[model samples]
Target chain A: MSLSIRHSWFEATARQRLAGLLDPGSFCEFLPPAVAQPSPHLAQLDLPGAFDDGVVVGAGQLGSRQVLVAAQEGQFMGGAVGEIHGAKIVGLLRRAVAERPAAVLFLIDSGGVRLHEANAGLIAISEIMRAVLDARAAGVPVVALVGGSCGAFGGMGIVAKLCSAVVMSEEGRLALSGPEVIETVAGVEEFDAKDRALVWRVTGGKHRYLMDDCAALVDDDIAAFRRGSIELLDDWQETPDTLARLRAKQARLQGRLSAYGRCRDGLEIWAALGISEPERVPLLDCDELIALKEGLPT
Target chain B: MEKLEFKFPSQALLAAAPPALCGVVGSGNLEILVRSGVDRQICEISVNTSARGFGETWRAVLATFAASQAVGGTSIAINDMGATPAVVSLRLAQALADYRGGAQ
Candidate 1:
C-alpha cells in the first residue's frame, strides 16, 4: 500500500496489480471468480478453464476519480483473448460509454488471441476493438498500461494503439507479431527469437516512446504506473474520435514509415532521429530518456 | 480432463461470510473458489482438472484440508492444471483463510 516501497509491475499478477493501482478497498470486481463462467471451449479440448477467463474487469477509484479497469492475467494461456475474455472487456467498454467514468484503464498483458479457440478468439478480439473505438468516440478516454510478463502483442497490440493514450514501462513490449511467431514463420535469420537484446530494442517501451507511439513511459514500478495514470487523468481533455483526427494519425504513421522504413535495428531508427549516441539510449533512466526525447526535433 | 467431487463434515460458517478466491488456473497451478450458503454440516468440493486419474490424490488432500479447517456450510470449486498435492493443500488453506477474512 505504501508507494515508497517499490513494487515491480512486471512481477505482480493481474489481481495484485489492480489492488496496487487502485485506492485501497475501491475495487469492486465485475465478475469475481466465484460466479463468473470460465471458457466453455477449453473443456472441448480437454484444457483447464480459469474462472473470469484470465481477465479481471471492474470499476474502481484511481486516486479520487472513478475509473473502469481491466487487467489480463498473463499466467493463464498467455492472457490470450477467448470468447468470454474478450466479451468481458467489450462489456466494460460499453459500460464506460454509458457511465462515462473518469477513464478506462486497460492493463494489457496479453499475447493476443487464444489459439485453441482460434476463430472464436479472433472474432472476440475484433468485437473488443470495436467496443474500444466506440467508447473513445463517445468521449470516454481509454488508457492502456503495458508492463507485464507477456506484454501486448498480436490483436491486443492493435487494441492498445487504438486507445486514447498509452503508458508503458521499459520492460513492456508493444508489437503486432511476437518475435517467436515471426521467427517461426520467417526463419531465425529474419527475426531471431533467441536474441533478447534485439527483441527488446524492436518492441520495448523505449523504442515505442521515442517513435511517439506511447503517450508516457514510467519505471517498472506499480506506484509509478499509478502516478502516470493519475497524471493522464489530470490532463484529460475529451477528444472524441473523428474522421479528421484519424486522418492525422494515419499521416503520422505514413511519416514514420517513410522516415525509417529501411532501418534494420532500433539503434538505426534512433540515429535517424538525431540521437548522437543511440546505443546509450537503453542505459538512460526514465527521466533521462524523456528529457532526451524532449530535446529531439519533432 | 476429469471432474471429481468430495464432501466432509466440519463446523458451520457464519451466515454472512464473504466468498474468496485464490491462485490461478495456470500450468502446474490451480484456483480455489470458496463460497458459503451450502449445507451447514458439510463442506463440498468439486474439482475440474486437466490431469486425469488423480481422484485418490485429490480425495486425500481434501480430506486433510477438511479435517484441519472449519469450512462447513461452504462449497469450493477448484480448477486445476496438474498442480501437485502440496500445492493444492497450500491453496486450500489460503482460500479458507481468505474466506474467513484472515490474512492470505
Candidate 2:
C-alpha cells in the first residue's frame, strides 16, 4: 500500500495525524507558527526558534462535540514538552473546562522534554500535571492516545497514567526510563538496549494492557486509533469521578513500589499479576490476552 | 566525564514558522524548540546541546541541511542534551519538515 504522510508513523508530523482524526475544514489551528517565541537562553546560544514548540495545542470538532486536542509532532525532538509547550497544553485544558467540551484527547508521542532547557521543561510538566488534576476537578474526562513511535516517557508517562482513560495501540510502548538507560545502569549482561524484542516485552502495549497500565489496545491505523478514542469520548460529557479513580490507581502504583520495587521486566510483572504462563504472556494475541485476565482501571 | 555528541537537522527555504518546542531532558536525551526566526525569509536553525565543541559538526550538518531543503525565510532553534547524532538530525529535520507541511 502507498504510504500517506498522515499515517507515516514517526515521519508523519502532528498536524498530519490530527488532520486525519478531525473532519477536514473543521480544524481551526490556534497559535500558528508565525508566533515564534523562543526562550531567551536559546537565543543567547544563537539557537533557531522552535515551531509550535514541537506540539500543536488547540481545539477542533471531532463531530458535533467541540473537543480539545493536543497532538505532538514527534518529528520535532521526539515531540518533547518544554515550558511554552507545557503551558499551551495546560492553558487549553482550562479552556476545555470553561467551554465544556465533550472530551479531551491527547496524542502523546514524546520522549518528554528538551534537556538543554531542562528547567523549563520540568516546570512545564509540573504545570501540566496540575492542569490534568484541574481538568479532573472540573469534571472533564481526559483520554490519552499512545500509538506513535515516541510512546510517552519520562514525566509524560506519569501524565498518561493519570488520564481517565488510556487507549494504546499494539505498537505503543510506555516507560519512565528507557531501556538504554537501564542497560547503562544494569550492564549489558543484565540488559541489552539494542534488543528490540526485549525492549517491547519490557514496555510494549501488550505488557501494559495485560498489566492494566493501558485500558485498551488497538491497531496502528489512525482511523482505528481515532475510533477507539471517540469511543472513550462518547462518555466525555459525563466526567468520571477522576480523583477517586486516581486515588485508587495511586494506591496501586504505590503498591507496585512496595511489592515489586525496581523489578523491570514483563515476566516479573506478569508473575506479580498472577499469570501462570509468564513466558507465554508476551506472545498472546489481543483477544486471548484479554480472556487470560481482567485489568485494573487506571 | 565522557561526553555524548549529536546533530540537530532542519532546513526550509520557503517554510512557515513553528508554533512551539519540547522534548525530554535526560542524560542521553534532549528536547528541542523551533519557531520563526527574526527573519521570515530565511530558514534558520539553532541548537542547544550539552556536548560542547561540536560547533563545527552542527554547522556542517546545518549547512548540508540548508542545501537539502528549499526553505523560505524561516528560523530554527534547538535545545538539546547528549542525544545521539541520529536523533538530533531526525528531530531537527522533522521539525523543519513539519513547518513546511503540516505535522503528523
Candidate 3:
C-alpha cells in the first residue's frame, strides 16, 4: 500500500500519532490538562511543569473495539516519567483491568524517569510495571508502539518488552541504557556515542527485529502502524497458553543474553546469527531487512 | 520561586470544551493549561516561574494577551523555566488559540 510522505509516524507528534492509531472520532481523554494534574515535584524544585506531565492518556476505539491509549510526548523532557505522569499511566492500566478493554496501546517514547524527581519516577515506573502485568493477567492484550525519536529506554524499555507485543518502525530504537550513558560507563572502545550507524545497529528496530526482540517491523508510516495494531487485535485471544509463551520468551531472552554476553559490537551478534554479510543489513529497508533476517526471497 | 495571578476581560470565548494544553516545560520553555473559567467575559491567569524578579515582565506580557481578546471563559495556568518574554507571550497565545480549537 502506498503511504503519504506527510504522515511519517516518526515525525508526527504524540497526539497526532494517537489520533491516527485510533478509529476516527472515538478518542475520549481522561484527566485532561484542565484538571491541572501537573507534577508538584517540579514546582518544589522550581522547575517547569507541563500540564499533563508529558503524557496524553485516554480511551479510544480501534476497529470498533474500545481500548485504553497512552502516548508520551518525546519533546517534553525527553518524555521522562515523573510522579504525575507515572500515576496517570498506572491509573489507566489499572482501570483497563477493571474496564477490560479490548487492548491497551502504549505509544512509548520515554527515556524513562524524570531525573529531577528521581525517587518518585522510579517508584511510579515500578507501579506501571505491575499495572502492565495486571492488565495482561486480566486478559487484556497490551501492545507497545516504539517509533518516536526518544524510543524507549531505562524502565520503559523493560515495560515495552513485558507487553504482549511490540510494533516498531525502522527509525525506532530500543535499549536498556541510552548510547551516551553506555559510552560513559563502558568506555569509547566498547560503545562509541558519536558513531550514528553503530548506535542504530545496536538498538535500532532492524536489529531488534532480527534479534526477535520486536514482534512486527514496519515502515515509518502511521497507516502501517494502524494496520499492524488492528491485525494483532483481531487475532487476540484470552491467552490460555500464556504460561508457555512466557517460558518461551524467557528462554529466548536467556539465549540472546548468552549469545551476545561477550560481544563488543552488534555486528558480532549478527555474524553469530549466520548473516553472510552483517554489515549490509543496516543498509536495507524494512521489508528487505526482515526478509534477510528470515532468509526469505527478497 | 515567582508566582503571579491575574484576570482580564476578553471578547472571544473558547471554541471547544475546557482543558486545552499547549507547549512543553523544557529548558527556556513553558507550558500553559487553559481551563473553563467562572465568568464568560473574563480570562483568569496564574503563572509560576523559576526565574525570580520577573513579575512586571509577566504582567506586561499577560496584559497584552488580554487586550488581544482572542479568548475568554478560560483560566490559564503557566509553568515557566526562565523563558524570554517572547516565548512567554507565544505560549500564552498558543494556549488561548488551542483552547479555541487551533493547532498547538
DockQ of each: 0.84, 0.09, 0.59
DockQ-better candidate, 1 vs 3: 1
What's the distance in Å from true for residue B23, model 2?
18
Native contacts kept (model 3):
0.76
Worst ten-residue run, lDDT, model 1 chain A?
A: A1-10
**Taking the tens digit of each residue's C-alpha lDDT, what string does model 1 give over A1-298?**
3458789999988998999999999999998887888888998899879998999999999998999999999989999999899989999999999999989999999999999998988999999899999998888899999999999999999999989899999999999999999999999999998998899899999999999889999999988999999998899896876799879989988998998999889999999999999999989999999999999988
Check candidate 3 and list the clashing pairs: none
| Best by the DockQ measure | 1
- The ten-residue window of minimal lDDT in model 3 chain A covers A1-10
lDDT tens digits by residue: candidate 3, A1-298 = 4635647888777888988989997998888777646777877887667777889999999989899999998877899998889999999999999999999999999899889989989999999999998999889988999999899999999999888889998889999999899889989887898998998888999888987789899888888899889987788675634688879978977987887899867799888888888889888888788778779322
RMSD of each: 2.1, 7.4, 3.0
i-RMS, each model, one decimal: 0.8, 8.2, 2.1
User: DockQ for model 3?
Assistant: 0.59
Writing each residue's lDDT as its tens digit, candidate 1 over B1-104 gives 99898999977765536678899888899999988755897999999999999999899889888887777889999999999999999999888878888422
Predicted model with the maximum TM-score: 1
Report how far residue A73 has shifted in candidate 2, in Å: 1.8
Task: Give the per-residue lDDT digits (tens) of candidate 2, residues B1-104.
Answer: 11233333334445444454434433455555555555444555656666767877777766776677655465555556567777767766766655656533
Backbone clashes for every candidate come to: 0, 58, 0
lDDT of 2 by residue, A129-219 (tens): 8887788767777788887888888989988987877888768888898777778998987779798888888788888887678878766
